[model samples]
Target: MRKARLGVFKFTSCDGCQLSLLNLEEELLAVVDLFDVAYFREATDKPLRGTFDLALVEGSVSTERQKEEILNIRDRARYLIAMGACATSGGLQALRNWASLSAYKARVYPSPENVHALSTSTPVSDHVYVDYELWGCPVTRNALSEVLVSFILEKKPALRGYSVCMECKRHGIPCLLVSQGAPCLGPVTRAGCEALCPALGKPCYGCFGPKDDANVESLLSRFRLMGLRSEECRALLDKMNTYAYRKVQGENRS
Candidate 1:
């Protein structure tokens, strides 16, 4: 059988998700054995020019050039998987979508016009079709490995759909919100990180994004009961997964 050719692409991001792939350590070698890494600028300087069997795309589309590049990659790759919070849901930079990019540029730079950028940071799916999405600030190595293995086996990757609360229960950790009145997004946030923050007695910061059918309204009401101001609750929901939360709010209002 011919070796599967893989390509890794990036846009506007911290490259943390690409780093996650490199951080696979032992599994990195295993992945290399399963597929030929035809293009990865972070790992090599070789010129990449061809279609690929699988392409792992990281980062959000934040510029016209990036949008063009993403479309080109999508056209060439047979399977395109969006990796990390940026590629999956526009990442932390999506915060600008809720605020004024002009004001931000004016405040931070001497000449705002010199900085060529788009008004909004959007996910990969906003530009082209994505076969799958791996959600995280920087996606977990275990989950990434599973995705790679599944692809090689021609099977669908089994990503968890439960909330962080389920992982907390499995780890036998006490609920930080109940015990210490801590603000937590665990009840609504996805269950991929194995309840890392809650296991250490802190609240889940929603790094893994919102779970399916998340009850944001109830969570907000609960937060308010625990003495969180409306503004504070809104701010918490406006973190990495702000777009998802906004969509939920829009749906509820409709």
Candidate 2:
């Protein structure tokens, strides 16, 4: 059987998600055997040519050029998978969405006029249809493996929709929020990291983004009960997955 043609593309991102794929190391050999790897600038010098069976896109649409490229990529690929927080929910750079882009540019750049940046950083889904989303600051190898296997099997990936707290329970890790009064987002954050930070006795920073059934208000109430001020609660939610948190809140409100 002809291997599925794979294309990996990058935009405004830290390339951490792509690194996770490469970090697969021993597992990468199996991925190579399954996919043709038609185009991947990070892994190979091969220039993009024909249509792809699958396109794994990382990063957000933070510029006009990227917006156009994503649209074209949508047309070229039979299936498009947005990888990481950047591609799925606009990454840390999306923090600029709530601020003055011009002011930020003037402060950061010597030649502000030379910088061609959009006022907002947004996910790929905002620009075009995304068949699937793999959420993380840098998606975990297990999630990548699930996606690859699902693609080969021509089935939907079995990503967990539960919160990270479940993973904590499964791993038999103590709840930092409950036991030590630490401000943890595991209650609202998605599973997949396997309670990594909590297992190490650290608070979850919500790198996996919000779970589908997240109760932001309830979590905020719990935080307040734990002696966190209103500002502290807001700050916690307004981190790496800010856009996603806001979106979920908006959906709940509407």
Candidate 3:
């Protein structure tokens, strides 16, 4: 049987998600054996460019060139997977969506006109049809493995959409929100990090983005009850996964 041609592409991100793939170490060899790995700039100098069986795309579309590239990629790949917070929910850079891009550029660069960028950083799904999304600041190795195996089996990947609170329950970790009055976003944030922050006795920062049925307003109310200021609540929800959270707010209002 012919090996499935795989492609890994990057756009505007910290490259942490791709590092997670490299960190697979021993398992990475098996993945290479199973797929053709036609294009991965991080792994090779000479990359084969063409149609791909599967494309793992990281980072947000933050420029006109990236917008065109993503569209072209969609046209070629049989299956496209948007990986990490950047690809799925615009990552940390999505915070720029709310601010003045021109002002920021003018202040940061000597020749602001030379620095060309989109007004807003957006997820890959905003511009094209994505077969799957792997959410995280850097997606976990377990989730990555599960997605790869599911594709090989020609089955739907079991990417969980539940809140991080559920993961806390499974691990028998006490709720920090209730016990310590910590402003935790676990009730709204998507699971898959296995409640990593909460387990470590810290509040969840919603790095995986909002879950399918996240109630942002409700969570805000809980935060207020915990004596958190309106600004503090906004700051918590409006970082890392800000684009996704803002979208949730818009949907609820509509």
Winner by lDDT: 3
- Clashing pairs for model 1 are none
Off by over 4 Å in 1: none
The lDDT values for all models are: 0.88, 0.91, 0.92
lDDT of 2 by residue, 1-254 (tens): 88899999998999999999999999999989989999988899998899999999999889989988999999999999999999999988888988999999999999999999899999999988899999988999999999999988888999988999999999899889989989899988999999999999999988889998788878888889988999898788777688998888777777
lDDT of 3: 0.92
Question: Pairing residues by index, what is the TM-score of model 1?
Answer: 0.97
- TM-score of candidate 2 to 2 decimals: 0.97
Which tens-of-lDDT digit does each residue in 49-119 have in candidate 3? 77999999999999999989999999889999999999999988888999999999999999999988999
Residue 4, model 3: lDDT of 97
Worst 10 residues of 2 by lDDT: 233-242
Instruction: Name the TM-score of candidate 3.
Output: 0.98
**What lDDT does candidate 3 reach at residue 184?**
92
Residue 155 of candidate 3: its Cα lDDT?
Answer: 96
For model 2, what is the C-alpha lDDT against the true structure? 0.91
